[model samples]
Target: MYYVTKDLFFPPVSQANRDGILAIGGDLSTERLLLAYKSGIFPWFDPGDPILWWSPNPRMVLFLDELIVSKSMRSILNRNVFTVTFNQNFRDVISNCQNVKRNGQTGTWITNDMIEAYCNLNESGIAKSVEVWQNDELVGGLYGIDLGTIFCGESMFSLVSNASKVAFITLVEQLKKENYKLLDCQVYNPHLESLGCREIKRIEFLRILKSE
Candidate 1:
């Protein structure tokens, strides 16, 4: 049920038929990437694979005001063992997310092409990163696109246990400080749920999409 667009940069995919996948095989040009973000879709494919866009049935999102910090996490935050910063080292954050050992993944979908694409987006001010450091050593962090009031979280990695969680908590705290409405997690997982993420229908999700 996906529709194809004649525009080379915009694959033939309709909002209604995302199947979670909205399109396949397209360049991540700034204009197209921006359009995709504003419409609640994003590209996710590996090297040698055609660009694939997805908008899952039940999107995972976190309301910045509702972030549930556990008592243990609250204790850690109060300790302030690590400091957090924004856009201090975007490349490093993305690189860590790619190279860090994930639970089950062997290689990474954050291919060179994806790196370059997101880097380009970062340069244009649509994407950003949150980095965590312990005594000046980069430990954990994450990165994503910022469409005005919506922060679309892409990925995160941790060099130390609880470090990435620190980064996530910091990011949410900052977003709340800035009055952002939503943090799009894209897919649902227990890890995110523990961090206070919940599912909402796609129709509900688009209502938060930014037009600009």
Candidate 2:
């Protein structure tokens, strides 16, 4: 376990523990966050805990071509039940992600500091948010770092059924149209699995991240 310092550097991802925790205690400065994402690491820790950086061995990712849009989701997409936009209402999207309750989690990892940091990233065009609106009301959305060809998703929230799914699927479709290479999901979960995200070896993921 490495402890971060004022110097902006991280140990190689190869040194990450079995659980993928690479380092501890680092500020979420835009510079550091950008560097971390480029290096295939991301911050994920409880509110009170020092910032924990992870590079899981089997990195979960979604190749745009492999995205699974279920028949119901396709029907929803065709219905145009919700309007989606990018980089619109980013602060609200992240805040909702912070407050939305999740199963097995007592609190949120998206702390106020995290929100402020990523919001700054958004202002600089390095971070992005996808908003889902219903009748002019923000119902669901997601935010993440955009590395040109790779998008490192951080978190998402939904107030109504399928709202987040709509945001996600729309984002995937847009990325595919834009010729994005990969969507780095960080870790595996059933929710993402249903959307066709799968785990790949960390080395393979790094290769994709570094590829043109």
Please report the candidate that would top TM-score against the real structure. 2
lDDT of 2 by residue, 98-202 (tens): 999988988888899999999999999999999999999999999999999999999999999999999999999899999999999999999999999999999
lDDT of 1 by residue, 1-212 (tens): 34445473443224536357776665778877888887788888777887788878789999987899999999999999899999989999998999998887778889887888889999988889999999899999999999878999999999998999999999999899998998999998899999999999877787777333
Can you list the residue pairs that collide in candidate 1? 3-12, 3-13, 4-12, 5-12
User: TM-score for model 2?
Assistant: 0.98
TM-score of candidate 1 against the unseen true structure: 0.92
Each prediction's TM-score against the native?
A: 0.92, 0.98
Question: Residue 27 deviation, candidate 1, in Å?
Answer: 0.4
Provide backbone clash counts, one per model. 4, 0
The local distance difference test score of each candidate is 0.85, 0.95
